[model samples]
Target: MKKWALFLLMFLLFILLACNDEETNEHVSSDQEEHEKPEVRTTPSESSKPKTKPLPEMTWEHLVNQEEGKLTANLDVDEKMSDQLVETLEKEITALTDETNDPEQIYRGAVDLLASSYYQTYFEKASTYDPDFEEPYLPDPEIEKKEGKKASPKKAFILLDASSSMLLRVNGKIKMDIAKNAVQRFGEVIGQDSDLSLLVYGHLGSESSEDKQLSCEGIEEVYEMSPYDEETFQASLNSFESKGWTPLAGAIKEAANMSRDFTEDVTVYVVSDGVETCGGDPVAAAEAFTKDSKERKVHIIGFHVDETAENELKKVSDAGNGTYYPADNEEELQDTIQKRWLPSLADLAWAHTKAPGPWEVLGKLEELEKHTNKLTEVRQLETERLNTVYRLIRDHDLLSSEAREDLKALLDERDDEIRTLIKNLTDEKKEDINKQADDIKNRVSEWRDRMYELRDEERDHS
Candidate 1:
């Protein structure tokens, strides 16, 4: 009777040990079910339920100009960077989880690691990176706006709305102060050979009905219509404050009047935080500016605006045959001013230079393609780094066979995601490049026709 009892006790103990060793795995949703919440994981075995530490952080930054769209990545596997990736992964396994460790937990972490917000940082900064690196960056290579030494550089007539709304603080700084910095920085850039004229509206009176007439009629060229002079521009920027109502229509009309006599093409940039509170038709005024001067282009930057104000600003830009840029911060504001088409065609001496516009534009496109090529290297490098870390862990038997396989799958999945992002972004940028190229081609064609007409008239008169 005693021996039978002992045998039964040993059998029960054996069953208990077996049950404890049966590890449960965590399940992550595949691509098709990505949006759905991850299903609850089975109860992990005592040996598999290890304490997890937070994952390592990864970031991508611009190694070049945003217009170049170049991103930095370590393809050859930097030991320091890889080491951080490994330590985070190591915490997910337990003392008893050796060669028999299941893959589910490690995989879930891998999915989170790939979806890290750091990956999206590139896009955030890329917005200011020159989304519409328009006609000025490289210019329409064929048309020349600067014809002689006496000819002035293309004019950049910048309009500022000094309505009381601009006094609102953002990130601890007043919006007017921020705009001042952006405008000054924009004026400081040389070699573009563009003269900058600073204009401000609604800077004269308070936002009271008694002062409404004063504010609405207030439009002043604080910075004279001259080449960018840092000291003078600074003084001009200091001359205004966020004091009154928004006279958007009056501002546009004033800009048109200022540039009416400019023989070369002109670009007008209006920076405002609100719409036309003065009850004027801003869109029509912009349209008239473009109509009166064929070479004039109008652009608007909505600074810290709501949806309604943005919509109205868009209409103004559209009517003026220009684009609308929204800037919530100083960096974006500066980028909006500096990054649109550089002094390309306007700076090119027109005295003896002319080329087929489309070909020149295509040539510039190649430079962009070369810049984008750097993205392909990101996939190859990240995959290699993951494989290296995996092999190191596998050879040392850090995780069970199943976990190793799952990690490999996770690595592959992450690599695919990075590739897809690169492809999509590249395609979008290429489309934009094509559109800008078409625009340049149109401008060049128009200029050629105008020149021919002028030449024929000269001959007829002679």
Candidate 2:
């Protein structure tokens, strides 16, 4: 009986030892899996840290002067500058995470690694790898097309609203004061050849018609209003004052007329934060100024505007074929106007959309027909598009041959105008005119299918 008990104890000890060995093996396997890397990955050298050469340096003046459509590396010293910035941020992140290791630092180091990898790829893709580079990194080309036309440069007339509303505080500062600060930065963007005229409204009221007429050109002590010297433009921004009701519509119209002597590509920038208090339609005024057929497009910027007046400002901008930018407060307003408008104006200047008017020389009535032809083609396309919808709804049997004949005649007349214009255009203008003709052709093709459907529906009902 004693020998049998001893045998049982030995057997139990063996089972316990086997079980513990299995659990130990499992733990070791799990740890090994955690550290395993992809088959292709190799350990990097300690001394060989990923590196990227610095980007091309750009001065503030040079950067602002670059063509508007071109990508600009503006002085954006924000959260994404470099590895150092990432490193600092990582320390903060690690503190927030409560990790034993500095996870924030690790994250920043990873970001730096990514940026360096991209930079190396860019260099390799540019085929600029150094002779000593054993494993050169190359990035794919980002933008392929380089043939895009640049916008033309031009003189600018900036009109700022300095009415009572402009004095209303927003983002802890008055609106007019913010606008003035933005205007002061204009000196940095304006090219040597570009002339800038600053105009403000609602500073003073005049009962005299003469004063009112001059008010648009009113020099309320040009104390830095007109940039006589660089110093004046800078100092003037600090002294801008806001008072009274804004005669917005009149101010726009008058400013447009006064700045007529500027380059044909003149840009009129209207900065305001409210609806027109004076009795004039801002949209109508914008439309009229742009209607000259040779005038520059008017752009409107709404800064820190209330809900009451947002739509009105947008209307004025759209009517002028200009972009409307909304800036919530001072800093953003300054950045938006400078970073967006200045570049846009530069592009507009390069576009030279305002070719010297054909009417100026009074060369030939035939030449005038060329402009008329483009207008005709556009109208024909519009008419055909509209007719397609109209014909679908109408009873075909109700339509007479006379109505169809009248429409066909009108279309023929439009074609005749295009043909006549084509004979007179210079080769360059001919291509543009031809493109318009082609657009009309496409519209007509679409209308033909619609017309057939209308006829079939009419027949089925009959």
Candidate 3:
């Protein structure tokens, strides 16, 4: 019985100790939940990197207007480095040929030199800024500019020199008659819906010394600036006779004066038979006429002009950014007007995009074409350098014959990648330009429509 009681006492003590141990474990677990943590393995991609090292990143500053803040960028391109390019290309090719005869290595090394990034120190994007290759100092393609919103209209201006030279006969008809006929036909086509004007100079006084001052000063606008009307235009053409001194420069100056205020483009056609007889700088006048306007052309047609006259007229045309056509006879004059001049005028009017004015109509297109030139140059230069390296390896008998084919295939692959890049970039530029153009057009159309409605409302009130 004593043994049994001892056993029960021991068992109760053990049970109490077990309960204390369980409570202690529960307390430790609660503390652990409050303060302590468990460890876990993490992947490199999922973890945060150390800030000590930074990766290279590209910068972009989109175009900003009044709403968005402006941002500036470096406009100047690096100095030309063709010499450096040649030298470096040679060095790289030589190194590749000497170090390894593998055509793949040589090709890749050559390609690295041709990369756009590699040329950051040489040319910037300015190397391909101008498609014509004449204007090299143009602004960089990355220039930030607001979307253009100016509308362009096509207008035609005919400058008829009615000096006594027009009195001279050609073939069976008078030169004046031929010129008048051509002008009438041109009006029929160009003035179908477009604005047209006819200005006659040197038609009041005789083409003599005594009347030189009067003839030079006498300038008449036979037809006012408006759409062509057959009856009115014919009457205006017959308003004056051909008898006066040639005031070519004065006529150009006056035309320019008339065109200065017009937001629309004025294409001028000058019909003359001689140089400036009144001692005026026709060249300077032509230059100024085209300088301040949107897109003015001064096409000069010479009628039986001497070499000196042709030369002078050619200069004037060149200054005006136009072509000079020399017609020796009546048939030649008519043919020039019918075939070359008239067709060109109609085409010009047709080809002219009726959109917002002067935001570089061919901006992205020009850049795109120019970029191809640069890429072509890059490809040529890369291939040339690689070929040199390949030849060296071939001469030294260092590489297998199969290396040639392998290098060629690699070059082709690189070129394919470049082509893909060009396509993608082109698509992006085209989409952006088209969107901007469309936006401007729609906005302008709405504004003009609203303006017309308001004007009509005012008229009704009146």
lDDT of each: 0.66, 0.51, 0.65
RMSD in order of candidates: 19.0, 31.4, 24.3
TM-score of each: 0.42, 0.38, 0.41
- Model 1 agreement with the true structure over 1-462: per-residue lDDT tens digits: 999999999999999887666532112325346667578857678886777554333223421222211111321322224465555445433322442354545444333332222233344443223333323222221232232112223788889889999999989889998888776766655224677888899898899999999999999999887777767888889877889999999998998887777787787888899999999999999999999665677888899899999999999999988889899887677656544222323433341233335556566556555545545554455466456546766877777676688778867766776677667666777677677666655665665555455556657989
Q: lDDT: which is higher, 1 or 3?
A: 1
Model 3, 1-462: lDDT tens digits are 999999999999999999999999999999988786776755345245333323112121110111110110111222233565556555656666667555656665554444333223222353323222111111111111122312212677889989998888877678888788777765655675468889989897787799899999987778889987989998888788899899999999888888778887788889899989898899999998888753788889998788998999999999998879899986577555532111233333433243434556466566665654554454444445445545555666555689766876766665565455445555665566566666655654554454455556657989
Residue 22 Cα positional deviation in candidate 2, in Å, after optimal superposition: 99
**Prediction-by-prediction clash tally:** 6, 11, 2
Q: Model 2, which residues run further than 4 Å from truth?
A: 1-152, 191-193, 205-228, 238-240, 339-462
Best-to-worst order by TM-score is 1, 3, 2
Please give the distance, in angstroms, between residue 105's alpha carbon in candidate 1 and its true position after superposition.
54
Tell me the deviation in Å of residue 221 in model 3: 0.7
Q: Which number leads on TM-score?
A: 1
lDDT of 2 by residue, 284-387 (tens): 88887777655466778898886668888889888876768888887667656443111233433432222223342233334544444443443344334323
